[model samples]
Target: MTEKAQNINLNKAKSNKKDEFYTQLSDIERELKHYKKHFRGKVVYCNCDDPRVSNFFHYFSYNFEKLGLKKLITTCYKSQDMDLFSTNNAERAIYLEYEGDKNGNMLPDASDIGIKQLNGDGDFRSEESIELLKQADIVVTNPPFSLFREYIAQLIDHDKKFIIVGHQNAIKYKEIFPLIRDNKLWLGFGFKGGAAHFINKHYEDYATAADRKEGMIRVSGVHWFTNIDLKKRHEDLILYKNYNPEEYQKYENFDAINVNKTKDIPIDYDGFMGVPITFMDKYNPEQFEIIGVGIANSGLEIGIQPYKPEHKYYRKEVQKRGAVNGDLYMMINGVVTVPYTRIIIKSKKL
Candidate 1:
């Protein structure tokens, strides 16, 4: 491989190694509680979880009867150990199936659960795992961050309902944004304080001293992506700010007034407005129409044009900071400034 290709592969491997954060039971329960109604009589699959230590397995098995679930299936990638995190050390992997409480003890018992080995390494993309996925009604798991795009595409291609975890930045991805724009997927009731505390062993904690916990990694911008509809999805955001030309700067390349914060979105403005990515959290289709994203390629798709020739020097300056053709920019005090990633939307009600 060329040096560039080798470097990319190395980086991907490093990223996948750091993608082993285990979901906390409290975090799972908090988000699942909001969707209990959707779980009734459904076959739930935790394809990325090891039944031995995964809280996703624990939560579903424990709540199978409570949720009136038809079945609970969990599969581990490779490791068979009961360790805090899997290192994928084993050549083969296993899956588990639980059908409520067979002994009537009101709890999932090991004797009642069925454990089976896979011919393959139990990767979610493996044919054996895909067979299990076909039988499931809802797939729930914390998938690997590095493989998130492919993982989501697989779920979409299979037409399977899912509530999977991923970084919030995935919303802007070319592969993912179209799904959100078309209402095929959406954000779930996210982690507390917009960050998650995951059980982990291989990474150092970068959380503040006040937020740090023993044996856990605090990852910001993590969110649950799901096709299952949420009650909050239809609730309109309470916008209090009124639009003013001085407060909201109009982008020079795109005809949209930029609002730095979601909460500050103007209620009166009916035209296209550019807002931060966090706006997705409060987006209600009835209240606003998602125009398009305002980043390079997506920006061009939404009609964002190149900088005028008169400001070529300014464009060159901003390009050094990662700006490119079709990026949305505006003059702030006579200086060319490219705004951070923005989602263009229009107020439907206004």
Candidate 2:
């Protein structure tokens, strides 16, 4: 699709309010396997989940004793935690608190679950939820994607460790990038194939070419963001490319060289290189220093490359090599456009 058409679709998606993406149990196990050790004796809050269908609750409750969790709390948006096909009869938001099985059964059964009403609608920002947040040691949930920024801010504000799902595109957000740049957050083991198939009661089926299940929507560009450290965050990305000015050209409006692909980062180059936002998944804090991000009118203290839909993307060819007058833009065959969101960086000693 043309850049202009893509932007129109993206704009519509940005304002869209369809945020009911139910994560499958398999996806939970994929990432949570690495975090089991952190949950011991800690209260886990799946504050944005529906206890009736939340795999998060399902997983933790079943593994509560194994993980040494003190308690498991789940809050649902409004009163929508009933059977998927049930008619609406409730008006108040609700929550469920599980303190593990009381009997010798060692299983988290429905009889042992305690369901309660919330004084508010259970928005994660509600005072009641904030009180619960204060009680939690770790927050884990697939929050509403549209509110990812606000949701993550709340967690960071409370200094809570979290494992949550959001779009990979969020890495460029002003509120999010600084956290990554400062090493306060990093991407978790992302969704397989960089796409997630989510279930929803509202959508019938998107019928996309990826994995399409009944009542499911396939969303690409999804990733998990967290504060917890992982082994991948410390591993170095092997570099093999050498700098060639003909292939690595400067941006039309920025001073940094444009790296079309992360693997193509040259070992000999030391200056700032603007790599794709996906670089976060493979980012090793020890190997590269995150300088900043570049976007159109970002005014980010680092650099800015304003997004222009009319411009076409070119591969390894430059129309012009821009100067440092602060207004230089990289052109390809005389066509100028904004590059994709990039995570600015420079390599460390090999």
Candidate 3:
């Protein structure tokens, strides 16, 4: 099939699938209502979404209007019907059908409100998207799972506020865990019971018996992530697992521990304090102290060896010889590195 023809088909398929997902919105309406209450009188951006298929639209569109939301910006991979959200007031609602190239390359137009759509895959990694993010007060959408890292990073980089949907495992992503550790973000109220309804790939409302249902399948757990306050509307469950002292003692020199997977934590240790990566947001410098981090890789060590002054003078001589050199020197330890997991020392108060 031609690229245009395929795009048309894909657009239809996505629209249908999103419509099916909307059927489940009623189950989550109460929580969504609370989420929307926080966005009253605010400009909301829904990137990588069609309003019809979006929970943000299905649940909060009316509330947004009632609360005097200044604007509602929604975009799709291709221009399609968005009449469902059309209101008489142009200031309150606007929809854009992003046009992509023959190869499916598209960017968010200058008129586009929030992050510029880059690569047209619905991920928020484009330069324009980052710029739009700077203006946003809150983002509400179900972003593509593949680009959750980049999406969250852009939000953090610009310090933009957002409410996004993703998988539960996203809490364990090396990049995401730190945000929680530093108290910059936290988990939403949902996903406490372990399973949520997501529209299946066959466009079924729920998982069918015939679906493969294996690792990284199309059908998976859908979670909500946001920095917005839900106003004490959540059930208190142990979001962070407790650290086992037995386990910490076994891993010496580790002052504190964050158990992304509580069940997998080691056994037998002293002074090993455990908390979930979500605790990053709750991290108190007076309570728990971070010591150091470790990375497990041989190739990285080998690649930087030449730049080490003690190992050889090749790196220094290249600069001295004017071999297109700059102030690039590889050091063994002075540099600060970000780690997936770090051992922190807990204060007596915590």
Candidate 4:
């Protein structure tokens, strides 16, 4: 094999060998307990995992047998490692062949009802995977960070109940944020601190060197986004404080100020309602509501402004041309000019 291929293989080997370093946290355990009760005598699927190194198995193996799970499905792209941990009640659990591995010959135990190996990926998007998703009462696993968006889309599309692990920033995505806003999702308990170790194939010596020093493969704080009950563990942090119309009138150049009110405000306003960033979390169609949200700088006009660079040459050219008044500038990416303004809006219902 080529050197690159050899390296990839070596990395996979190392990850498999050291997989035990990763462990589930208490909050994850609590969530699983809730799941077991809710999905008693139902099938559960763990997508994007090796049965041996899977967080799903680590957390739920004992509980599965106790609850008499109908089936536990796990997959691997290359080899089946489901035999690492043996459960006494093997008859109840079944292993199916993933369709992607045509040559894979792993078979489920006789006690298992049947085999259902089919095509799938770390992202869990295959016909069999979709079928498993449809059949499962709950999906619990740590999906690959690379394809988190697509993975979430599948769950939401199917309207399945799931408790999955992902980067905390996933909550900030435009697509994801709306779900939390609409009360279709919520952040789990123990989100403030983060979760356990995640040993992986790409353990770069330098890129992850700092995290290594800290004794873990640290990604951004891992959080649980779910339609399941999270028990409202974390205290809600307010986004806006001391909000008043007079405080914002001076910065009228901006379009609006986003404020998160601690207490619910009256929605009986004639104008638009500017919900705070926190409003994204509590937004409910039946109760609270959202009109719209975007970049609105009250100080400057809603157009862009371009200024010459601070270099000596640029400054000289600017002096020669005289200071140009506000030139229309192209807003790129997340950068935007906001007037000393706050998001303002009117609310009615509550």
Judging by TM-score against the true structure, name the best candidate.
1
- For model 4, the superposed segments whose C-alpha errors exceed 4 Å read 1-27, 33-36, 65-68, 79-123, 190-197, 200-215, 233-242, 245-255, 259-350
Q: Count the backbone clashes (under 3 Å) in each candidate.
A: 0, 9, 18, 27
How well does each candidate superpose onto the true structure, as a TM-score? 0.92, 0.85, 0.52, 0.56
Candidate 4 lDDT for residue 215 = 39
The local lDDT score (0 to 100) that residue 74 gets in candidate 1 is: 92
lDDT tens per residue, model 2, 1-350: 23344334435544444435578889999989988889999999998788887888999999999999999999977746422222223587889999998887999987889999998877889999999999999999988666788998999999999999887778878898889999999999989888777776554444455467677666667788999999889888888989999999887666689887888988989888889888888999999999887753343466564433333223223434322222225677776644666777888873
Best by lDDT: 1
- By TM-score, highest first, what's the ranking? 1, 2, 4, 3
lDDT of 2 at 265: 87
Evaluated against the true structure, the overall lDDT of model 1 is 0.83
User: Candidate 3 residues 159-254, lDDT tens each?
Assistant: 778877665556656687567546577656554333454543433222345543422112244456777655442322233334454433322212
Q: In model 3, which runs have C-alpha deviations exceeding 4 angstroms?
A: 1-23, 79-135, 201-222, 230-249, 252-270, 275-350
| Ten residues in sequence with the least summed lDDT for candidate 3 | 82-91
lDDT of 2 at 187: 96
Between candidates 3 and 4, the one scoring higher on lDDT is 4
